[model samples]
Target: MSPTLQNEALQSRAEALGQSLPPLLAEAEMLAATLMLGEHGRRRAGSGDEFWQYRAAHQGDPARAIDWRRSARSDGHFIREREWQAAQSVTLWVDPAKSMAFSGGRERPPKGDRARLLALALAVLLLRGGERVGLAGLAQPRSGRSQIVRLAARLAGEPEAGDYGAPETAGMVGHGRAVFVSDFLGPIEPVEAALSRAADRGVRGALCQILDPAEEEFPFDGRVIFESMSGSMRHETQQAGELRSRYLARLAERKDRLSELARAVGWQFSTFHTGAPAQSALLWLYRALEGGR
Candidate 1:
């Protein structure tokens, strides 16, 4: 197929992915099952084994007098109902902005593509596990698995997010977890600020920094022109060897800074390369957040 046609096909697939399960969706299902093995009280609602506080026996109280054991001990019969907690809510904050589309060296699925895949996978996993999910992108407020297909379709048609990005805060609701999936290529301060805001609101979050393998290895040989993914700037490289050290140092610093930020704020942070299997990355992310302890 033609280049445009190929891209369109990929787009269509990504969108359908939200509602329709992919062949490899089993991996995500595995992760979800692992995360929610014993978790309950949300997806499947039924009379649970939980015993909450007793309430006043209202009119037409059961003859058994709920908490009859306690009533025999005392004098009053009180009705007891299980405290039902809604399912754990998880928000998939995907950086649907255009910047995520960068492919550092050669033609490969861009970082943005992987980001979308991760977000959708996570959402599916959570949904399967009986959790409500929220979505944020260069756009915002993509919520609920019911809307997953449409959200994915919209993201498929979206352009690369800008350097200065927007955030999704309005739709974040209920108590649960938040997962921010992005390369976070723009200004560091804003990204930190956004995370801080989420943290402040008691929204626990994790950050996944996606990168291209070539970006780290400095694979360009002789001469190359490097363009910024956000269309902000470009760099010309005469010899990749000469810039190797600088590139590595920057990479190291970025990793350290991200790790430190996550540590200080109690959010999990992880980095993944494009060539790495994204399913493995999801596992690694869960491990990092779970502390392996």
Candidate 2:
């Protein structure tokens, strides 16, 4: 093809990619705005010049550590603590497996859409608070408003060909934080391996499980044909309702196993349904990450 043709083709592709971004970005910004409305950014304790809070002096308190003015106003000695001003790097992984595209109905967004929105919204909050955010194994951690565009583009990239998605652990920085958002209907072994590897690298984070309401409530009754989102696995059942007990049991077991895995790795885990408001998950994620640090 000629140079002009090549440039035109590239421009066309770029425009097509840009088209998918605004809705996700706008919705994410709106969702993030609701949380940012009446709240100040997260604050935690560490070594810094700015004062965080005052607490009673501990057993090993030195004379110099006590705040004379604050102590005089109080019954006991108080030590001034400073807020942690150092910024943190947060890497996020939103599962791109075809499974995440599943939606039980037309009323709500797909699991994949919800996952991306939450990821982007969380990134907006993190960036606003002066932290570096990136997509795990895809984008390196960087802080700036422009990074959100890159993240949204990457999040909208091609989906992996599989019935489920696995967390990507490569290229993770040691002692950094990460967030893995997925339906996690895949084999537990991959999830275990990813978390274990992250733990070895001292990468603590959270697991936000996004699922469709239909998947959670097994509402199918009569004859039903169930197939993986990738169409790689299929099963025909005469009575889908009968399998609800088994399905629910397995789901419970998976949740328990995930919780256990998270605990073992010094991480946190939470579940979000597509049917619920996105703010709840974003808030939990924001707090969970802040607390983890």
Candidate 3:
């Protein structure tokens, strides 16, 4: 596509993304709040204004290290220790390829929407916990709510380019975490190569495979015309149900390979279906970051 046309397409997509933000943002916040009520609530250590704990004054302590008021209450002086100031940067990517546009039915949201929603919602949770978040292949990692807003805008506005697969991360630096949200239905070799590259940079992250219920269930019967999203392949079958067993087996094999790849690199892998609540995936994602597994 020409640059001007690409720009226009990006703007149009961004506008469409913007229209969905209010609801998505609200849902994300709600999920975060719900998770916070449980034992897995937001726990982050950073050099922020929040007080972490108080420790006894140690040798070589600066004259100003003592808490005078606390000293007055006890013979020993105490020094307040604030939370760790350093924030970890997390780069996120959601495949926006044509395949992601598939929803299987008119009543369901596209796989791309689910991927984008999970990516943004995870960003919200991370930002709230004082971590830097960025959209992989789109923007640099940044912290605070502003970063979330900027990411949402970018996600909404950018038109997907390139074939369906992993987003390039060659320009990214640091050993911090990364999150890839996608249907992951593409060929395995390229995906493995991309992830291997990221691992070479000391980057460890999670792979979240988001798929439509139909994709998982293969709930079709009678004659069906299966079309490829990239318009490169198509298959017409008189007995669609007959393909279900083989389809599911291939999917299982794909997921198994992906899981093995992640394990070999000491990363994490997860799968989410659109029919389920998004919060479950978001919560799992948050915990994965915490455990680094």
Give the Å shift of residue 38 in candidate 2: 6.7
lDDT of 3 by residue, 139-195 (tens): 899887788778877676543554476556744567888888888898788678878
Residues 131-225 of candidate 2: C-alpha lDDT, one tens digit per residue? 88999889999998999988988887778888788899866778988999999988899999999999998899999999999999999998999
On lDDT, the candidate that comes out on top is: 2
Candidate 3 stretches with Cα past 4 Å from truth are 1-21, 37-85, 158-163
Please report the TM-score between candidate 1 and the true structure: 0.67
Q: Is candidate 1 or candidate 3 better by TM-score?
A: 3
lDDT of each: 0.64, 0.90, 0.79
Model 1 over residues 103-157: C-alpha lDDT tens digits? Answer: 8656566887777677766666555545566665333434456655544554455
Off by over 4 Å in 1: 1-85, 104-107, 137-145, 164-168, 286-293
User: How do all the candidates rank in terms of TM-score, highest first?
Assistant: 2, 3, 1
Clashes of each: 5, 0, 5
**Total clashing pairs in model 2:** 0
Better of 2 and 3 by lDDT: 2
